[model samples]
Target chain A: MTDTYFVAVDWGTSGFRLWVIGRDGTVLDSTTAPLGMSRLKRNDFDRVLEESLDKLGIAQDVPAIICGMAGAAQGWCEAPYLCAPTRLDALGEGAVSVRGATRNVHILPGVKQMAPANVMRGEETQIAGLLHAEPSFAGTVCLPGTHTKWVQVKDGAIQHFETCMTGEQFAFFSQTSVLSHSMILDGWSDNAFRSAVRLATQDPVAVPRRLFSIRADMLVRDQDSATARATLSGLLIGQELMSVVHYWRDQSVTLIGAPPLCEIYLMALDVLGVGGRSLDVETTTLAGLAAAFHIQTGTVHA
Target chain B: MTDTYFVAVDWGTSGFRLWVIGRDGTVLDSTTAPLGMSRLKRNDFDRVLEESLDKLGIAQDVPAIICGMAGAAQGWCEAPYLCAPTRLDALGEGAVSVRGATRNVHILPGVKQMAPANVMRGEETQIAGLLHAEPSFAGTVCLPGTHTKWVQVKDGAIQHFETCMTGEQFAFFSQTSVLSHSMILDGWSDNAFRSAVRLATQDPVAVPRRLFSIRADMLVRDQDSATARATLSGLLIGQELMSVVHYWRDQSVTLIGAPPLCEIYLMALDVLGVGGRSLDVETTTLAGLAAAFHIQTGTVHA
Candidate 1:
């Protein structure tokens, strides 16, 4: 039995989730808090790390691997962002250095592609987890989150990936836009989503023209909020799928994320006549951290 | 000349504009303030009026006529709303009681049409001003503002009108929507507006399809904010014009309000192949009140 411990942290904008694991990658204990990177002040990452570790009864000396925006420029530590079209081996220089931490800490770098404005911070971890989950998981692996990522997983490795701001944009439009008054705020409406997806995929070119119909249909026809939200979601996801269908069609796709978000990707795939299966890689971040920690310490357990 | 002075109060939601005129309809002194009906607390309207009148150097005894939302359910005083397809004679019941200072205050009632979900409070004054400018003007008098009004003017009367929440929707979408990041905040672009208008008018039925394309074009082609703004404006105005083109194609249109807002209307008319002249009815409320006063007092000046 090995005494070396491993930890995986999925730190998002507003929340931090950490999973404590043993040598076999079995989660021993898990904890979550609202201390996301956005709430931290300048140069306060060390204190936050201590607080997180203290809550878990984990010693500062225990090595931990972190992913997500924690390593972003706005993160607790200014971990350099890795350029996109990247791979797990080419994650470059690894996590940022922090001072005054109770234990050794390493934050994963996010990938950013300049050409198409694609980016990912946390989805890379999920992609890595999906790859780890399936050894021969070649083809495309999609991890949907606030920023949905389309990663090309080949030869047991994450070769390349792209991020779309579709999720964030959808939330903004549905909650804050004028259409907010006419959209479904709570609960999911698959019917509305399906019709919207149809509108988007069948006549992909008509997306720009059909947006006003959302308002007009509401005003003139009294369309319900659910339909409106679905219509909007369909348009955005449809457009994204349309752009990537050429690359994803006739290939295998592995979806990873929360069930609801993953369902959206499945729906999009189904609409495009693509075959795919969903893997419940809920703790992909932990898996990814396990992989990275092995590489960092060069400690392979028997 | 009679000693009685008439006051025309164009009290709207966010601001109040008043014109103190002699019985002959000459604007003696004008005043405007930010105390619109929407901002006033319960019973605070009297103070707003008193302060506004003090600025205009007008006494409380003047026979004042108030129009616009100042008489709605949330206004200074509830001037009963008039149903649409109404005649000029069916406006506010001669006078409404004012609480504060002693004055013969007459509030013009707003129009509320049932079928189309159209309602207007202050537009009657603009429509009245349009009739005053061209006594026998027929066809549609398009008054574009935060909420645009397309009133069909015929036989020296407002035959029918429809209201579209285009402007307010545009503002909401541009400032708070996902498109906000892709659009400009200000500065009018006629070229962009014209192109959008062309698209809207040429294919009113396809408006819903084009909305998403705006973002695509902006993202893929790096289009300017001006083009985005104009395209949005054009799409709305073009759709609106297409709705009422048959009603005013062969008749005359008198555009009212500020120069810039009126330009869009003029452009819409031009796109519809309709002839119309832009009229700067700077003090439309005062003129409207004068006409109403003449009709009420039976003065034969014209």
Candidate 2:
């Protein structure tokens, strides 16, 4: 039997993922549940963690490292934010320990920027993993999600970052706004997307008006549902790109997220003549948690 | 009892307002209901109109003039759009007559712009009313609502117009988005609103980022809900202003809308250092509908 060294948990607002990692730096076992921080009360966190460990047959002796909204003020334990410019490797120092827990439990802190007033949880761990994988990485790192982050890193630290509600806007608009009547979920049109991207990027201020055009297109020209969805997505991504083009204009961006979203970003970047590469979200998150664990146990140099 | 010469109906997507106008151009009596064009099926439109007329004891001999969603493709009858560079007074010529009804009914057509693709139903009539009230009125006319319109009018005709989804965005965001957590309905902060308007107008591309700042402001600095609401309103209106600044940059604009919405636009224009005046939505809508009725019956001169 492989010896389980520690448990890595990425406890987000609406998701819970746990991994039993062996001493050999490999995942021995894993489990995922919908018991995210949002679903658990403060007292339920310990019981929920214990239940998951019991189901996975992990011994109580195995220490656990947690990140994401579990460290939010309303989560298991409050892990306050570390203000930028923050060193990626020093994230472990800000970890808050869960009181009265049988096994060692450490929740990672988020990163906050004061000037532009930005806050990022969970994604910081992914950034840490990104830094560990490419030790000398610099330039921009984009983590696209409900609240997408465009982070600028330099010399192993996050210099600054900006957050855009692009994903959230897309979800809300496609589900609740008038655009819902025109958007379809299953198909996509690359040409429609590129055209929208070009239009939005060329005239960012025209965003509000352009958004209405999707409906007009449907009314006047009988636009298809798939093309409408792609156009909507492109319009949003293009507007976001316009806002952050200065951060990654000539530099190659490191996109860390789920494949479908990252693919969209890559396409949009291609249209803008910007270069970028993609990395899986889970791998980066696990690597980041492992790095923090190593720092916590004083076993490895960052 | 005073004579009710013609019925004027401003039938929107979710609201129905009717006014019985005398030959003297005075409103004899009026009633409002929730039976908007959207609420009634195609077959139910005539029945609903007849019922409302019956409730008001209106004579069957009276002709009716209808505007807004009642003329949409999915409404009682499709009143096709009149392409831009259209004369306001000529709107009566574009009115589509509804068949199989005892009384004569005319549904006014909306205006459509091809280049940047925008459509306006009901508001065009309001523009006509503005033109009727102020014959030499030129420059820009703004009708702010669920879909706000910025019209470029010259010589009593709509040269071109752009629609911004600012009001719809405000309603959706304040009620459903994450920003809802930070918003309050009752109080408002003029200072916070002005500051946000200034920021968004100066950097319109930063609209998305600025929106997230509302949440960050609440999270980091304990921002008040009223301030958050004001800031959100300011940000959206400011973005719209940025998009249509060319229409009213140095000109004194005529604003037509409900007082609350118009007042906000007025404040936003003031922040942008643009001149503008406000008119009541109902008054303008009635005037427009009356003008359409006159055109259909050839009763009044433009």
Candidate 3:
């Protein structure tokens, strides 16, 4: 039997990315589509997968591993969540197989925190990747995005985590709320952002009032649009920090997300007098998916 | 010259209500329209008012006193906000006249707080009405609505106030957010609401996390949608209370709004162990507009 390579896919709600990896885990090719899980039907996932493989000039027999919303109940195949306190490498074991596919396909399950009732899909794969990179990593991992996750990993296992809808709330408020009038789509104010963070940290309960005050400031104080945008971002991020700072305040914190957002989190952390380092979410997710793929095919230790 | 009754209009952002009040302050007739400030262009306000008067068979010669968004800069006439630390009765003094109108039309000015930069249009009229009803009322006035106003009244004057976008945020989040899927629009759970209130009051910063947990709870525990809706409401109101409970905690609080929403605020205040009494917003606005009308015509004391 000839052993060649496989594809790793991070199929999120609003995005899709596929990477063809060499037998030794080198990325041979990659492609992405805006056709995310939300935009695809159940059968459409298989069709899209085949089309993506064809575009990449990959054979139908090549195996593939998937992560994120693709594993959700509404996705291609429902990959039931693996309850927490579970080892990161064990993600592959909870993966559900995509039956009737010409190629070998599996979807990784998400992590679920039952007590507080929080669930994370694609981020769990990123955590798995982070764990694979730093096998002995302990303390907290902050994954910032639309739904930012703060995970505690010790001894190669995720202890517990929390999710904040800070990014989504920012998107919703800036685009649809009254604050939209005062916000610029692009550009930011560092000073305003940091000042907002300090204000939120000092009196976290005043966040709701502060949010309205952003508009009032714009109207009464003639605040700039860039400052308004940054202040909004800072307020939401600050609120998130106020809630979850306890998770990383006393420990080493590593952020994983797009550089821009991670930088904001880092700045927020700095404002709170806490230290944090950032890692690329894409790299972590790819590494995590590749690690899961390796574990599934028995090429690596779990 | 004969002195006849005049019309009092509480024109808000999304609603318009007009009451014909006699010289003795009795409501002779009343009517309402969905044509609020947001729905009308500058020219449309005059036409709408004229049409509304025609529908009620009102004489064009009879003068009208307007409050709320009709007095906004974007409305028929710009009634600049009266800065705080001013008596509620003095609202009449800031009234702006509608130019080229067949009948005498005066739009009462809103109240603005400069430091924290808060503004209230129609609620000021309601506050004025509250003051008219209780001239010696010295404490907090919570006018709950799309923008809930927490006004500090002392010696019949509005000292300062803060605006919480609680109701607006609730509307936006429940209608447009991921949490929308987990929410049932109509039914509510009192238990879930109170529990969420307690959760928010105890750890106000956990609000962003608690919001996402509603979706998580629905997914993991199959929580009911009604419970999710109530919880969302409770969380927002609780956060509002956490921020401004100081205003009402040590003083008398008069709740003013439609009964349903005012009940929620009352319940929230009750959870905080603060006593409050509810007042009808319409009645308050009528009394307020009437009081302002009398003052504008120099028929009563300011």
| Residue pairs that clash (backbone atoms under 3 angstroms), model 3 | A129-A288
Residue B225 CA displacement from its true place in model 3, Å: 1.6
Question: Model 3 residue A2 lDDT?
Answer: 24
**Residue A127 miss distance in model 2 (angstroms):** 0.7
Provide the lDDT at B183 for model 1.
Answer: 83
RMSD vs true structure, all candidates: 7.0, 2.0, 2.4
TM-score of chain A of 3: 0.96
TM-score-superior candidate, 1 or 3: 3
Candidate lDDT values, in order: 0.69, 0.88, 0.87
Compose the digit string of candidate 1's lDDT tens values, residues A1-302: 43538677888878888887876667878888898887987567667766777887777678777888788666777666666556664442476655555577788777665444445677777766655565566788777766566777677555565555568667766776546767755546787787778877776555543554565466546778877888888877886676566458789677888888888878877877787778776566666767766766666621
Model 2 stretches astray by more than 4 angstroms: A101-103, A184-186, B184-186
Task: Give model 3's TM-score versus the native structure.
Answer: 0.96
Pick by lDDT: 1 or 3, better one: 3
Question: Each model's TM-score, in the order given?
Answer: 0.66, 0.95, 0.96
Q: Model 3, range A1-302, lDDT digits (tens) per residue?
A: 22448888999999899988887667888999999988999989999999989987899889999999999989999999999988998898787889977688999999898989999999889988888888888989999988899998888998999999898889877887878878855678999999999998888888888888888887778888889999999888888988986797777689999998889999989998889999988889999988888788778632
**Candidate 1 deviant stretches above 4 angstroms:** A1-4, A92-103, A134-281, A292-302, B1-4, B54-63, B71-302
B291 in model 3: Cα distance from truth in Å?
0.4
lDDT of 2 at A258: 88
| Per-residue lDDT of candidate 3, residues B1-302 (tens digit) | 22348998988888898888766667778899999988989988888989989987888889999988888767788888888888988988888888988789999998887898888888888888888888888888898888888989898899999889898889977887878988755689888889889999988988988888999998999999889999999999999988886788776688988899988888877787888899987888888888888888888733
